[model samples]
Target: MERSKTVRKGTAYWILGVFAIIWAVITLYPFIVTIFSSLKTNDEILGSMLNLPRDPVWHNYYVAITGAKTLHTIMNSIFLAVCSTAGVLLFGSMLAYVISRKKHKYNKIIFTIFLTGIVLPIYATLVPMMKMISKIDILQPNAFYTLILIYIAICLPEGLFIMAGYMRGISRELDEAAIIDGCNTPQLFFRILLPISKPALATSAIITFLACYNEMIFALLFITDKAKYTVSIGLLYFVGKKTTDMGPMFAAIILTTLPMLVFYMLFQEKIQSGLTAGAVKG
Candidate 1:
């Protein structure tokens, strides 16, 4: 009977594994097709949707990179993502630390306010955001960074949520010890807590960076100049009212997605650690 039970368990495990594999392939099928399609000619792609490339058109990459101004768009995305992530990490973590450590009415009020952002759809604020920005005359197509504050504002509340949850799991004894060591508030936050909270910070950084990188609606509404476009906006190069260019478009998409794919592959362990940080109390 025990042997029969063990065999049943093994069979169940095999079935689950097979299901997982099928799910993975199903999800990854589109990306695989996109990668292969990018290596085909426009006619070949339309002609042979599922067939492997007979003669790979590697020049599609060069065309996408040069013709679409991929470098400038990628650079813009990188700069915006990096700066926005930095701000989110520093400000969000500190705010979380303060709110978690102090049990006060105003802190609760602040925390509640930040929580509201998670429920709020950004589209609801678009009209108001535009109206408010229009009143300020500093906006320019070249000065796209005038949108940095908006990015930070959109990012901060979510970052604060992750950080505040993580920070709560941290013991007050550490803060007391830091105080005992003659550490000031800034020193305690910057020197000790920040390093210890790396998992949460990394999680927030990656999420915030992805959001800032892939954001299109804001970029579209705020920016009009092709020279100042992000990779998301750069996607328009292959699209037209009448027809869409397939090969170069797919190539650009693959190129655009590569950075994110590489980033996740590199830091996957850190991200996993951060995600499972609260599973066990240290």
Candidate 2:
């Protein structure tokens, strides 16, 4: 009976392995097709989508970067991503720390308001957001600083929620100790809580940055300036006189996607470790 059970388990594992392989291939099909499509000419792509590039044209990458201004937009996106992420981390963490630790009647009300922003769709406020941006003389969405500020604002609620939860996991003893050692609230927060919350911060930062990085609607609607356009808005480079600019666009898409791929590759382990170690239990 033991031997028979062992054989059945082995057979089940093999069947599952086959299904997993098939699923992986299915998932990867579009990306694989895109890579090959980027290398092939339009005629070749039209002729046979499945065929390998017999003579790969590498200039598509160069053209997409240089001629299509993909590299510049990518640079624009990086700057925006970094600045917006920093703002979210610095401001969001501070807000969370105060709200989570401060025992006041208004604390719950404030936190509830912040959480409600999660369910508020950006589309609902599009017109008002535009009017508000226009109303602020120096705060045009086309301006990089203005755009980053908007990103930070939109990102704050979720970050605040995550950081607040994570902060609760840290003991109040540390705060008491810091206060006894002549530390102010700011100092205790900056010096003690900040270091302890690194994992939660990392998790929130990565998630927020990626969301802002890939966001399209705000980028498209707010920024009319071509030079200030992000990678999400850079897809217009693919549209030509009559049809889509397939070849160069494919290359651009891959180039646009590479940064995210590289970012995940570097920080995926950190994200996993951080979530396990830093997240709150209850």
Highest lDDT, which number? 2
Relative to the true structure, candidate 2 reaches a TM of 0.91
Q: What TM-score does candidate 1 get on C-alpha atoms?
A: 0.88
lDDT tens digits, residue span 30-82, model 2: 89999998897888888887999989988778878887788888888888888
**Number of residue pairs clashing in candidate 1, backbone atoms closer than 3 angstroms, sequence gap of 3 or more or interchain:** 0
List the candidates' TM-scores in order: 0.88, 0.91
Give RMSD (Å) of candidate 2 vs. truth: 3.0
Per-residue CA lDDT of model 1 for 182-262, tens digit only, reads: 999999999988898887888888778888988887887788778889988898655673335577778888998888889
Which segments of candidate 2 are over 4 A away from where they belong?
1-11, 236-245, 270-282
